[model samples]
Each structure stands twice: as structure tokens, then as C-alpha cells.
Target: MALTSIKTSGDKIEIVNQLLLPHTTEFIEIDTIEQAHDAIKSMKIRGAPAIASLAALTVASHLSRALQADPAPEWLSSPQLLDPYITAQLDFLYTARPTAVNLGAATRRLKHTLRTGVEQGKDASAIAQDLIQEGREIDAEDVSRNKRMSKWGGEWLIEQVKAKGKSPESLNVMTVCNTGSLATSGYGTALGLITYLHETRKLSRAFFTQSTPYHQGSRLTALELLTLKIPATMLCDSMVGSLFQHNDIHAVVVGADRIARNGDTANKVGTYNAAVLASRHNIPFIVVAPVSTVDLDIADGTAIPIEQRPALEARLVRGAVYPFTLNAQGVKEQATVMVTPEDLEGVYNPSFDVTPAELISAIVTEKGVAVKADGASGFDLSSIV
Candidate 1:
């Protein structure tokens, strides 16, 4: 069976506890806007698209509960009160993760729906219903668009190889971090492209980096590939340069947390390293993302805020203990072991790194594939976004 990051049944929303993933499958229900915000902030649920879906759905569920209350909530009594309450909740959710722009986009979309409904002279109940519908739409739209971008990116990579006088069949691709369904509402961004190739019988094998610190690649991506029965190999982050030196990696595809107008991308921290190595090896470096990830407000990557993780997160590692210890619940017992000395000072752990547009060969979205001009260093994404 395929894995999903978030699951919904009617108005109830639940997310897998990613911290104990691969070894344990635990789903935590999100009952309110506060629960959604806390899930994003605590890294219990992540990925740009997944984060946006959870927030939007939580809002819908919150309002749904309010509508069924014995006495309608004060906020639901009037559009005037509903506006501030919903706006404040959306703002709080946006602040939970500052770097990924998708959450901001989702919140803004809900706010827009609320504003438009009110301006149309709709009653409080009607406006709330409109917001609820918009929120559900936000989550429902993710899967279709993800599949679209995946095909665009996957086909583009094939053509780029053909132009180089190489057979496009059975190409080897490298990716970093976790970009599969576990990271998104459905399909994926970068990993989805890899899946596209696999489904089309154009993939040789998928190579992934361990993505140190969080180890999303080793833990999450590895599990997803294994579950799908896709042939894959796991390598350490530092070994990317060495892998390029020896292996025939045709492309390095990555997903973005934020993409500046110039096509400068901020993604998982180790992505820049892979891009640089790909450049040295003459491998194509492609970025696969949705149009919403493009922040037209920002002219360059420098303007994109990079989130810094807690120092303790970098100092510790989590996994099921070796020698096969199983708890009474019949699941492998997981533990967090400290990899460094207690209270280690100066642990530099930025969750993401920005890769310049010059290093990117192509940026694929649902709209189309974008590449730099003949002599251009950056992308004119205005056309694509």
C-alpha cells in the first residue's frame, strides 16, 4: 500500500507521527487550529504542501464544529466577529513555519475567501460555509497538481538527456531529503518525478542522500521507496561528491520550500551541496515544485527566510534500537540517542539552504518546464508562475 502523510475521514484530520516512522505507524488526530499549528511547529508533520493542507483543513473542521454547537460560537454569530477570529488563527498558523511559503499562500487563500464572501453581503453562516468549501478545495487540489508537475518534470528530464546524444532510457537520478507522499498531500515534487520515471520504465535506479541531522532521506524517503518497491540506494550526505565521481548520475532533482522570482531556491539544507556536485559532474540539476511555492514578492533567494532548527535536534538521533527490542504493543521500541556531548555549544543547523538559479538547469511546475535563457543566469519565472 502507498503511504500518505495526512489522512482525513469526514471532518476528522490525522497525521502520522513522523518522528517514529518506518518502525512505528502512529496517527495523531488534529482537533483544532491550535493542534494544526503545533503539529507544524513541532516537526510532527512537515513538507510545504502537507503543511498547507493540514492548516486549511483544520480551519474547515474548526468551523464545522462551531456550526454544530448547541449555541453557535460567538465568532460564528457575526461576520464581523468571524473575520477577526479566523484571520487571527490563520496568522498564527502562518507564523508556525516562516520559510515555506505554501502555508502563507493557503492562509491567504482562506482569508481571501472570507473577505470576498463578506463583501458580497453574505451572512455569517453563509460566509463560514464558503470558507469551509475553500479550505477543502485547498487540500483536494494538491494531488492533481502534484501529478501534473511530476509529469512535466519527468518528461523534461528525459528530453534534456536525449539532446546530449544519450539514450533517455534507464537513467539514474539522485534526490535529497524526503519529497515523496510523506512530505506532501499526495504524489510529491522531486520524488514524484522519480516515480513518474519508474512508472514509465525510464528509471535505472534512484539514489538518495541520508540528509544528516534530520535524516529525512534515510528514514522517510527510504521507507517510501521500499514500500513502493522502487529500486533505491541510500548514501551519506558527504558522499554525494564521491557518488558523482564514480556513478553515472544523470540528474539531481530536488523540491523547494521557497522559490524566488529569479528561480533561486531554498530547500533541504544539503540540497546546495548536491547541486554543486552535480554541476561539477555535468549532471542536470532540476527543481520540481508547484507554482504556489514561487514567491513573486521576493526578487532573490537572499530575501527568503531560512528556518533554523533547535540545536538539540542536531545533537540527537532517533531510530528503533538495534538487537531487536519490541515493546508489549508488538512494535519495535524507538529511542533517541545523543550523538554529541550534552549541551554542545555552537551547533549550526539551518533547516534549509538556497541554491542559486545559475546552478539550476530547470524548474518544473504544473504550468510547464522553465529553463534559463541562452546567456541568462536566472529564470524568468513570471511566465511559469
Candidate 2:
């Protein structure tokens, strides 16, 4: 029951509609660049890496189709004409989700490939082929890197426990949001490390927060863990502190949307709250993600741009009607109900929050694990990136 967020066949692309997860599985086709943009922006296909993959694959599909057209498109006539057209497409894709650094990284990488190919005197068709290959590679590389970082983070946690004169066996862990197979190409980020621990027989039970407004935790991560047959418990977003207080939780692991140069991490909205509580409970707080998530250009967390979701999104909840409302198809009848007052004037719905480097015990990437220098308040991630 390995769940895939995106699926592809040659130049055709499709993504699972994550909004209906845990209850329903629906695959929606992504045929055009605009469709890709809408899917990412609408959270039809989310998670930073997942959206980046969709964006890259969509670009590849577009170029591959253009190359096979009966009457060649005007933009494909020459590199001079091709450069701006492709550039505009990349720019448009970047605007789909502004907060995810991975999307920007993918687009920037493609632009560099395009520039280098043109400078090497490649023809427009050759350049198109090069761009297409690079885009596909961007999606293909996510799973392997995820596996590497999961091992790195999992082993680091075990060592940290042993150093504290505590048994590392059967460690209880808590996670903030969904970071399993449904969130990436495969494996995962933080959830991958939890899986690594379980696979190695070191995990007792995994706890996850029911991330409010999006329920990514209860819906997506819960499904992933159950599919893998891992023992897990679900708690409300408000229960993280209580879970830490009553449970011998070894660590709080989470996935990041973006990481600043000084090691500040931006993740799901409730992550900062979990980090603060973990710090108070003396629990290790780890950020697991690929290197592409790090943005060296941003000096600190304050500079990270937070995308605020629509106010209406915070006021509505979608789920199967209680008491088992089943349709003729045998699937539960789902509906979106207004949870807040119909005319509620004030609703705060920022999609992410930044956790200061001081609160984070370590950051793990495919390269390795990074910790702050002795007596330092922040990490200089210059080498890690």
C-alpha cells in the first residue's frame, strides 16, 4: 500500500487528489502547465517536494509534446526564441507556491540547464531534449535522497539517546505533520526516519498531531503508517505538549518547507508550537528534508515569506458524514461543513511557521546531520547546503 502522490507515463502526468485522502483515492490528470499550477496552488498535489516534482514533470511533458507537433511551434524554431518562452513557463510555475523553496530550486536548475545548453551551441530541439531530461531527473532523485537522510537522522537519534545514558530501544517518537510516501516521490523526510526506526526494531510507537485546517496528519500520515503496519497514535494539535509531558518521547521529528541560512526552519503552521514544547520537555527536535529545501539567500527566519491561506479554508472542514453515510457506490458520502460562524470576520490561516535555530536540535539532509557549534545560538549551514 505504498501511496504515490504523483504518477506518470511517458509525457502524461497525473496526481492523487490528496484533499480526499484516507477516505477516497482519486487520480486527476495534469495535461497543461496551467493545470499543474492550479493543482499545486490548490493543494490538490501538495508537500514541497511533491509539488516541485509535479511542476518539473509538467514542464518536461510540455516540451516533449512541442517537439512532436506536426507544425512546429514558433517558439521551437531557435534557442533565441525558445529561451524566453521556457523562461516564462518556469516563472509562472514558481508563482504557484511561493513559500516552498524546492519549487524555486527546481525552476532555477532548469533555467541553468537551458542556459548551458544554448551556450554549448545546441539546437533548439536538442536544448528541449536536455530540459526534458533534467526535469525528469529532478523528480527521480527525491526518493533516494530521502532514504539517505532517513538513515542519517535515525542513527543520529539513537546515538544521542545512548550518549544520555538512556536505552535507545523501543523509543517513542512524535511527529508534527504528514511526511510519508504521500508527501514525496517515495519514502519521506521525517516520516522516513520514523519508518527507519520501526524497520530496525527500535520504535515502540509513533505519535502524530492532527494538523488543524488541513488534517494532513490524521488523514495522510495515519493512512501511510497503517498501510505500513506501524503502530501509531493520533492526537489533536493541542495534545503535543500533553503527549510529551506524559510520554517518554525521545524526539520530535518534522519535515521542513524551507530552511534559512542560519538554520531557521519553516514548516507546517503548528511546527513552531511543537518545537517550543519539545524544547521545554528536553526532547530533541529534528528537521528532516532534502538539501534543495535550504535557501542560502535568506539570512534568517524573519525574512522567510509565509503564505497565508484563504480565511474560508480555515472555517471549513471536509469529512464523511458521521454515523456512516454511504452512497450507492459503497463509499462514504463526504461533505464540506462550515465549522466556524458563517460571517466570522477574523480568521488567521498562515500555511507555515518558522522555528528558530535554537529550538531545533539538529537538521538532517541527504549529505548528513548538522548541529550547531558549541555555545552557538544558530547553525551556519554554509557547508551543509
Candidate 3:
């Protein structure tokens, strides 16, 4: 069965608590705007596209419940009040995670919907209805876009291998972090391309890095591939270099939280290390993300913001016991243990790192695939964006 990050039934919205993933599956509800904001900020729900979808859908659900309230909210009394209230809510959600451009894009799109309805002189309720539909659309559109970009990336890799006089069949591809259904509205970005190759029988194995500190790759991506019955191998973050030296890796693919206009990508923190290693190995490094992940306002990676995680996060690890005992509820019992000394200091833990465009062989989006021009150091991105 496929893993889902968020589940919505009618007006209800629930997301899987990714922090306790692999060992356990837990669902948490988001009924209020504050709950959605906390979910994104607290890292209970993540991935650039997934968080954005949750933020948008939560707004839709909030408005839906308000429209059916015994006494309509005062904000619904007029377009003026409703507009500001919803705008404030969107703005708050955007602040939950500043690094992921998709969250900002989702908020901006809803803001646009609100502006269009208000300009048409629609009533407060009418404008609220418009916002609801737009929010739902934002979440609904992610899956199709993911599939399109995955296909574009998967086929492009095959062509690249074939051009080098090598067979595309049984190609081995590597990825970092958890870019799968659990990381997005549905399907995925980088992992989606690996899934595409698997479905088409062109893949021999799927390789993923353990993604240090958070272990999204080990805890989340490993579970995703297992559930899908995809053949996969896990390597510690530092093993990437050794893996490339010992194996015939065709490419290293990853999902982007943000991509500057020149194609520099900000993704999982260890992504840059993987990109640098891929370059040394002469392996193609591809980034697969939706067009929304592209930030036209940012000219390069230096301008992109990098989120720093709590220092304690890097010192501890969470997992089930060695014997893997299950509680009365048949759920695995998990615990967090410190890997370093209690008073350890000077631990650096940034949530993401930027890979310069020169290291990126191609940037795949729903629109198409983008590659740097001959002898060029950066990508134009005009055609893909």
C-alpha cells in the first residue's frame, strides 16, 4: 500500500506524524489555523509541497466549518473583515516554514484568489467560497505535477545514459531524504523519478542516504520503499562517497525545497555533499520539484534562506528498542536517546544546504527539463519556470 502524508475526509484533515515514522504510524488532526501552523513549524508535517498543501487545505477546512457555524464569524460579516482575517491566517501559515518556497507560493496563490473575488464586489460568503475551492485545487494539483516531472526526469536520465553508449536498462539511482507520497500531496519529486523507473522496469535498485540528524531517509524513505516493495539500499550520509567509488551509480536525484532563478537548489542539508560527490564521480545530479519550488525573486543560492534546526536535534536519535517490543495496542514503543555527550556544544545543524547550479545536471519540473548550456555555470530557468 502507498503511504500518505495527509488524509482528508470531507471537511476533516489529518496528517501522519512523521517524527515517529517507520517504527510507528500516528495520525494527528489539524482543525484550526494554529494547529496547521504548529504542525508545519514543529515538523510534524513536512516536505516543501506537503506542508504547503496542508496549510492551504487547513484554510479551506477552517472556512468550511465557519460557513456552517450556528452564528457566522464576524469576519464573515463583510468582504472587508473576511479578507483581512483570511489574509492574516495565510500570512501566519507562510511564516511556519520560510525556506520552502512552495508554502509561500501556496499562500500567495490563495491571496490572489481572495483579491480576485473581492475586486469582483462579491459578498463575504462568496469570496470565502472562492478561497475554499482554490485551496482544494492547490492540494489536488500536486500529484499530477509530480508524476509529470518524474516522467520527464526518468526519461531524460535514460537518454543521457544511452548517449554515453551505455544501456539504460537496470540503472542504479540514488536519492537523499524522503521524497515520496509521504513527503508530498501524492507521488513525489526525486523519489517519484525512481518509482517511475521501477514501474517501467528500467531500474535495478534504488539507493538512498540516511540523511543525518533527522534520518528522513532512513526512517521515512526506507519505510516508503519497503511498503511499495521497491528494492532499496540505505547508506549512512558519509557513505555516499564510498558508495559512488564502489558502485556504478548512474545519477543522484533529489527534491528541492527552493530553487533560485539560476537553478541553485536548497534541499535536505546533506544534499550538497551528495551533489559534490556525484560531480566527482561524473554522475548526473538531478533536481525534481514542482514549478512552485522555483523562486524567481531569488537570483542565486546565496540569497536563499537556510533554516537552522535546534542543536539538541543533532545530538539525539529516535527509534524502537533493540528487541522491538509492541505495546498492548500492537504499536512499537519508541524512545529518543542522545548520541553525544549531554553538554556537547558547538553542534551545527542546518535544515538545508544549497547546491550551486553548476553541480546540477538537470532541473526537472512539471513543465519540462532544464539543463545548463554548453560551458555555462548556471541555468537560465526561463523555459522551465
Candidate 2 lDDT by residue in tens digits, 207-316:
99999889999989999999999999999999888888888999999999999999999999999999999999999999999999999998899999999999999999
**Whole-model lDDT per candidate:** 0.93, 0.94, 0.95
Q: On residues 95-163, what C-alpha lDDT tens digit does candidate 1 reach at each position?
A: 999999999999999999999988999989999899899999999998888899999999998998999
Comparison by lDDT, 1 against 2, better one:
2
| TM-score between model 1 and native | 0.99
Q: How good is model 3 by TM-score?
A: 0.99
Candidate 2 vs 3: which has more lDDT? 3
Q: Which stretches of candidate 2 lie over 4 Å from their true place?
A: none
lDDT of 1 at 81: 94
Mark the regions of model 1 whose C-alpha exceeds 4 Å error after superposition. none
Candidates 1 and 3, the one with greater lDDT:
3
Backbone clashes for every candidate come to: 0, 0, 0
Model 2, backbone clash pairs (residues 3+ apart or across chains), number: 0
Candidate that would win on lDDT:
3
Tens-digit lDDT track of model 3 for 1-385: 7799999998899999999998888999889999999999989988999999999999999999999998998999999998889999999999999999999999999999999999999999999999899999999999999999999999999999999999999999999999999999988999999999999999999999999889999999999999988999999999999999999999999999999999999999999999999999999999999999999998999999999888999999999987889889998889989999887899999999999999999999999999999999999898888
- lDDT ranking from best to worst? 3, 2, 1
